[model samples]
Target chain A: MKGMTIIVQTITRLVKIFILLYGLYLTLTGHLTPGGGFAGGVVIACLYILLTLAYGRQWALRRFPRRLAGSLDSVGGFIFLIVACLGFGFGGMFFVNFLERFFPGRPFALLSAGTIPLNNIAICLKVAASLFLVFIVMAGARLLEKKDRTYDYKQEEEE
Target chain B: MIQLLPLFVAIPLGAAFLTALAAFKARRLADVGSALATGALLVLAVITIGRQGVYPVGGFLAPLGITLVLDGFSVLLLLIVNGIGFLATLYSISYMERYTSKYKYFTLFLLMIGGMNGVVITGDVFNLFVFLEIASIASYALVAFGGEHEELEASFKYLVLGSVGSGFILLAIALVYGATGQLNMAGIAMALAGTDKHLLIAFASVLFLAGFSVKAALVPFHPWLPDAHPSAPAPISAMLSGVLIKALGVYALARIIFNVLGATPLFGMIVMGLGVLSMTVGVILAVGQWDFKRLLAYHSISQMGYVVLGIGLGMFILASGGDSVVAGTALLGGILHLANHAAFKSLLFFCAGSVEFRTGTRMLKELGGIQEKMPVTRLTCTVASLSIAGIPPLNGFWSKLIIVIATIQAAFTYPGLLVLTAVTVLVSFVTLVSFLKVLRYVFLGALPDAFRKIKESPFFMGVTIVSLALLCAGMGLLLVPAARGAILDPAIEALKQGLGYGSRVLAGM
Candidate 1:
């Protein structure tokens, strides 16, 4: 049973990594393609959801951890803001695409599209962590309900 | 100065997501983290008001790519969104303890804030819709956070009405897009400058107005608000009344009408009619309410009516080619009232939460004589109530006074001005009467037998309430010339520019 669980966990982890990579791919190509920050972020969150479901809550918690997600959310928002601020600093007004002048690299390249790629990544991190946190709180409440059994008793009493 | 514009949305969004993630393990950390995030945003909003300029997004020239404009109008909204958001977060820290899932609450709270910020900052019309939905969706879910019968019912009502409103807005956007072939607001303005499709524009404008009016909970579309606002948790109640309606509904409506569509006299008349209906009806309904939070919710509709009336009058004057000074005053009073309302309303909701926390009920008759037990709460509640009633020395009075003055100056016939003014005064009286019922039943009467062991709320909650009460007093200072010029004038100017917004954004780029 232990070996089977281990194999299942490994497979789920591999699948999650694949999803994460796919989300990144979409985010990077967001400006040129239909998939953008919100779509990519939801995809990333789906991977996290899969991991949590496949390998129990404890396993998911141990790997991703709350602190890491929190930091990543903050970092993503900050990067998006910084990218906008950089435009202002270049005397291009707030949120102007300053990278066009400074980095002026090819227009449709992976690293091109000015601040679009950075914004995509930032939005991805934000949405993923936000949705994951929502799931955690909701699922945690359910888990607590299973252990306590008091809610069930109370419901019965009320009924 | 311009560099900090993006921080308004970024800080709150970042903080909300971070708080949500952190709360999973160190559950206690969510409160402080969310508070710090909103606090930072509030400060940034203040700084933004001082830095007057447009900030385009992605360095792309205007009319082609998306832009984020931070002008007087946007800054005014930023102050309201971030300021109330911070206080609401503070209140939530203690008030949300009863709920089983606190982290989820904070996460949704932040997403709502991020969405509102995005709505205020984005220069692209399509982007505004996206952000508006983000905020609206989160709010829909938040209303049902309690997961009770009433909460579920209220959430469904809000969702249906809100979805209909959103549909109207989307249809309006499609119409505008088809007409102008541009997604950017400024670009659309430029395209429509010499157009002769008055009937189509009018139709689209009506759709936008109806949609936004629903979101704002205007009298005609206000059935959902009383149920929705009272159903949410207290902090969220504060958010919905204090900021959400104004940002998502009133602000968006005003921006599109004045800046994009060039506010016509017909639009102004519709706005004023809605305002009068809401003010009269909301107050009358509020007076009969037994639920404390529900009463406050009804009053939100009435107070927002006052805001719409003032702004509508300004639009009428401007569209008629009347004196610019009087128009400016009207606009200033309307916008200032928006800010003032945020402070007082949130404070009122916080007080209601404190009462619920201590007395375990929001029903007026069920609550009695807990003032001695919760002195700080009583004081704050009194201050907030007095402010809302437009008592002198409080913030609400000055803004109302300005509106009344501007109405008279705008050459409103004596009877018309007198009647509107009378309605305003009557509404204030009704507000005071309802609050007095609250005071008498909840604070002055004999303490209920079941509440003997009740205690004051936690320190954070008290701190949040008291600070808001203080703002109730301090915000009156905006009437002073220096303060008015520094904070309020620019916002009025931004609106007065009308379709000039297109040129300004283009110029910045």
Candidate 2:
């Protein structure tokens, strides 16, 4: 499929960075704010999805390959686990906010809430990557189906 | 000890993700990583056997943050889940070689394990639902891993039904939350204590029964099992049939009915009635199947009935103010059978997998004389078949015997229970007959032309099947006095305490 209209593409190019930055802000400030990893992650995922729609699959694949997104998904989940396991090294229980002991920042701040903000960031990474992977795979399946149908049509014509 | 609780869920989650990340670079990372992760889990399960404690996640206390409980009941389930999970992972190292993308397979496998562990350890009802969804989704994907027409069909069926079950569970949890304003199990039970018979609680209870019965593959709700179990890779079939249903379905149902909702004689009768239905109908249907894995799947439903019957009987006795000894004996039989089935049923599935791996078919009529070619698989299959058939000295025999004796003793008091006792024995006899058909058709007949050159399964597969077979042989020893004291008694005591669990957990915290 070709790209969308030039106007749509131009607007997406201009607005995509702000959308991504807002998603970043929401994820980083999740512990105190209403929007957390799941909501903000969807927002971030929307940016890429918008890019894919505006520029087509080929353009998106060139910038952010499916393999990289898949790898990032796994790495994000591992980071979350590592943060939880680090609690043991800090002489506390599993999932304990060990960072609170070292840095008891003021409440309602972005850096506060111990390990929670870090966990939010990790989840945002995973959710964003996984959602994109799902989208790509589904789109790829549609393309394959179309190819199969056209190939069958050619074979029938030859027959 | 309490701190070790979260490791059950955390270890596998970490390993799965790391494998997913690193396996792209090093192809062998998935195999080594999952094996090590499950290995650690088995050791952790062993070390925490008799210890009981509560961990409040994030130090937010029980009523607010999630709590992980390591009671005797949870410990028993942990052993079964991790022990079988380790073997399944080990077998997959070799068995999954034929399938592509080993890393993705291992990632999903460990996630399923992590989810099961989370289900058993979590003390909050809503947390249980979350873990249940995680495990269910993973299993659904694993079932369709091969992407064959049959596999996809079965997986879609399972996924739809499983989602409906989850919906019922969520609705029930919402009802309970609305009624009690509590999410922690102990707090819910405390709030539910002595509350007069209310329709809301009854509605929640019925929803729990329907939801969990579907998960457990009980009769009338068991259409998906026969298809889903046979379509997956063999090791996966073993895992699904072995511990997943029991852990997700039976354990959750029993815990809620007995501890949270406070078991009553009426509920006991409903459970027992369902048990008898599955027991009679499952074997009856299993008797006609020629497909190896499909037959085994039907038998899973039958065996689960035995577990539910024994536990249900115990619940009836306890609620009706009958003899505590009899109640203890009955529940012990039920719980013991659960563990015993995990070993033998998984062994049975592994044996079927081995045959399929070498010969490329699971249809009983299409294969013959496998015993001569794959002695290890044949021997393990025989042992597992005998164990399931309740032959003497095998693990299945001891548990079935106890359940039978308990039922007969209950008959002396009620006389109506005599029907259940007779059904138990009759079911055992029919189980033997059906397995005899399997034996004759798959192993004892003359060799087929197509299968003559097939060899035995790989080294790790043989090791896994043999180890599980040995467990099947020796599991009866768990009934010995010393072992019983350490393992079975504590779990039974926890259930018998009923609503008292609320105060004990609260006091412990």
Candidate 3:
């Protein structure tokens, strides 16, 4: 639970914001460039993972709790679905990209792909939150498993 | 109405998200949410019957854009998935109260439903694989949801085998895409019809058979079923048995072979051979099992065999240019058996769950004289058992009879098929023996002293069991000409249309 050395912690603190900014940049420019929601989300998740590795579990949980991560993950998925359903509602079919038809943002612009960029943001939120949650849960389970093994060893020694 | 095709996938995905978010504090929200979502799907599935059209996702036309095709075949599968899904969710509302993370369960349930809906409805080959993964992953998570040693063990076995199956499918799809230069099913069919890629197509066909037989739990690849089916919670057992295998396994396999790949005699023989092997081996294994759910699990394999037999027979006849009427009869028998098994087998699992719920034991040796104690479960279980055993009046009898008759009629074309007819009858008889043992041991025998205080399952659970029983009894009416014309015949027609489905869908666009 005591995490890594002070140097790692200090570097993570200084470098974390830039990593987050880079992820956001990728997500924002996804439609125009190569990267999209998933790549950006993984990068953002790596930022949190780096922080968790640098700081202790307690420090990380205090800042970004598991419950919040789970809730946010659901919210992200819901938002993505809402975007699709909105297309269905406004247009006659599912995923009609009504935003593009009506607004038709300038080609090669940031908002050019109508619902695509919005969908990327939602996917970004989802992939980041869920990945972080998965890491935390697996980490917690490993800790419990270690405890269980030691407890079994002690019981055997006594018996 | 066709515009709503995407809703089949959307409703459950959205419900899963909302349930995960909102059902944390109010426990009933998960229950109500799952119920309402599946109910809506069931209603949609009913409305979808006898209607055929194509929905282009995001306004993209076929051969390029992803399409959701609604055909007779897809409609039948839609009805099965949503109908059984609704009942399973209802059963879970009570049964899953025992599990602490009810919301998580509901969320996984909805995701699985969405994935299945997507698999059946998608017109693109890759889309089917994606949906198949979604459903498979969710089922894997649910299988391990209990976090017990046995549950984890069963789930791991299932995961490894299921993943292998998926790998084969993905590789086959890659080959298909490479050979045909098409991702859409219609496009592939058209390409296939025009070209002579026999080596490539044949390799993909074998891979499809291997992969889908695993999904369908046909004989050679069914090692995961007995463990995986019984290890999950009971309602989940029903879903895996009654719906999942059929949708992801049988339905997907049949669609590819009949409609997309265009069935061949070699493929037909292999499929029928798998079906026959599964039927014999599954029942022989079941005849000896003392564990109640495990017995039912084995029976799922056997009954799936009957379905495969029917479809395989039809495919063979069609490929060999046998009598069209005989082929149609075989197809009808196979497809109707699929629906019939959905009702009876699911109900049987619920009955097992109920027995487990009250008595806290699934060992047939431990249960006795529960009939007086839980009359509804007892009655429903009896009905389901009779249906599964091919008794005179129930749904199972009608489908099995049709299959046997079709085989007999088909025997004139190929005398070898008479053996298939004989085996089908023999399997039905053995099934009766197995269920008879169940009735004798569990419901009709002396009551154990420890079980004197036991009562029936809770209201929701009993309601599911009874409603399913009603379905089992009345599903025979589906064989009637009028009902068959509306519900069953269209599905057969879809399959009968075969490679024409490609042109039909493209024309719609």
Candidate 4:
């Protein structure tokens, strides 16, 4: 049983890493294509879910605790707000493209989409972390379902 | 103003997504994170109230790419949505302790808030639909959070009707897009300025009215609300009844009718008729409910009707080239009521949650006398109830007075004023009766055998209830001239702009 668990954990970890990388790629390239923060965030969250399913809730919790995810969410939101505030401070309206001056007329490159790419990245991190947290917290509590002891564990075991 | 515009949507959206992810590891993290995020947003909204501008997504101009507008209307809605969202989060911190999955609750709650904020700020019509769906879907899921049979039934009913409403909205959008070949509200308004499609426009207006009215849970379409609202967790019920219908239904409807489509007398009459029907029916239904939350849910629809009637009355006066001041006053009263309702209604729901938390039941008949046990909750509930009943010196009374005055000022005659007055009085009376039933059963009578040890809710919940109760008392200050200029005037001006919104957007670009 231990060996089997190890194999599953190893496989799921690889898969989760792969998914995260893919989500990152999508978020980074969101400006040049249709995929953006929302899609990327969901993808990243799915990676976390995969890990939880394979390695157990405790393992998942240890690696990516709630506090870290929450902090990351705050940071992402702050980044988006700071970007908007920067625009306001730069003598333009809120969320104005202040970076445009530095990258004048740059067309369709990875970094050329101005604030769109940055916003997508911020949104991706926020959504992915928040969603994974929700799933973990919900799934973890299922462990307590049998604690009520309405039915004897021994009786169930005999069956 | 333009730069800060996206923050309205981005902050909440980011917070929601993060809350979902964070809930995976630590359970309590999402709650705290969401509360802080919403608190920041509330402050930001307060700051942005008088500021006006548009932010174009990417580097594209308004007509080419999406834009977020921060006008009076958007800012006013931002304050209500984020303000209520913050309080709900704070309340949930304590109230949700009994629920197994606190993270999921906070995540969905934040998502709904994000969706509402997005709906209010987005300048694109299609974007509005998308955000509305996001908010609506989250709310539907939250309503069924308990996964009980009753909750499932209520959620399923709400989902089916809500999808139909969304379909109607989409169809209306498709028609508008076909008519003007533009999805941005301002751009479409510009396109329609010289068009000879008055009949088509009118048809689309009806479609919009139908769609938004259903979303608002107006009289004829409000069957799902009483079931759904009562089934959700308490904080969620508060959020839903307090702000969800208004944001997706009334706010969007008013924005489209008054600003984008340019309000017509026919449209005004239609809105007024729906308002009158909903007001009469909701209160009548509410008077008979034995469930505490269900009673409040009915009153939500009834109160929303008053808001709609006030706005509709204002539009009627404006369309007929009557007194613009009276029309403006009517609009102001309606919008003020919208904000006031968010405060008092959410407060009522929170108090109900506290009562249930202590007593382990929400059935009015099962509860008997606990006011002495939970003084804070009883006090807050009384304040909220009085506010909703439009008692003197409370927020509700001022807004109701404004609506009554505006109705008479519009020369709707004694009959029209009499009908408005009578319905207003009836709804308030019904509200009082239902709450009195609540006070008598849950607080005033002998303490039930089962609830002898009931305690006040946690500190966070107490803080939230107290804050909202204070707001219920202070909200009348919005009637003051400076506050009106700073907050209410911008929203009214935004509506009065009518199709001129198109010109403003183009000019800003």
Candidate 1 residue-wise lDDT, B271-381, digit = tens: 988988998899999999999999999999999999998888888778878788888888877898899999999999999999998777999989888988899999999
Predicted candidate 2 versus true structure: per-residue lDDT over B426-500, tens digit per residue:
999999999999999999889988987898899999999999999999999998899998889888988898988
Highest-scoring model, DockQ: 3
CA deviation > 4 Å runs, candidate 4:
A1-159, B194-197, B412-418
lDDT tens digits, residue span B137-170, model 3:
9999888888777888899899999999999999
Candidate 3 chain B lowest-lDDT run of ten: B189-198
For each model in turn, which proportion of the native inter-chain contacts is also found? 0.50, 0.74, 0.91, 0.24
Give the higher-lDDT candidate: 1 or 2.
2
Q: What are the models' TM-scores?
A: 0.83, 0.96, 0.97, 0.81
Candidate number with the higher TM-score (2 or 4): 2
| lDDT, candidates in the order shown | 0.84, 0.90, 0.92, 0.84
> Which residue runs does candidate 2 get wrong by more than 4 Å?
A102-108, A143-159
DockQ of each: 0.28, 0.50, 0.58, 0.16
Off by over 4 Å in 3: A102-108, A143-159
Residue B375, candidate 1: C-alpha displacement in angstroms:
1.6
**Would candidate 2 be rated incorrect, acceptable, medium or high by CAPRI criteria?**
medium
Residue pairs in candidate 3 whose N, alpha carbon or C atoms collide under 3 angstroms: none
Tell me, by lDDT, which candidate is best: 3
The per-residue C-alpha lDDT of model 2 at residue B426 equals 98
List TM-score (chain A only) for every prediction: 0.77, 0.86, 0.86, 0.79
- Using TM-score as the yardstick, the better of models 1 and 2 is 2
Q: Order the candidates by TM-score, highest first — what do you get?
A: 3, 2, 1, 4
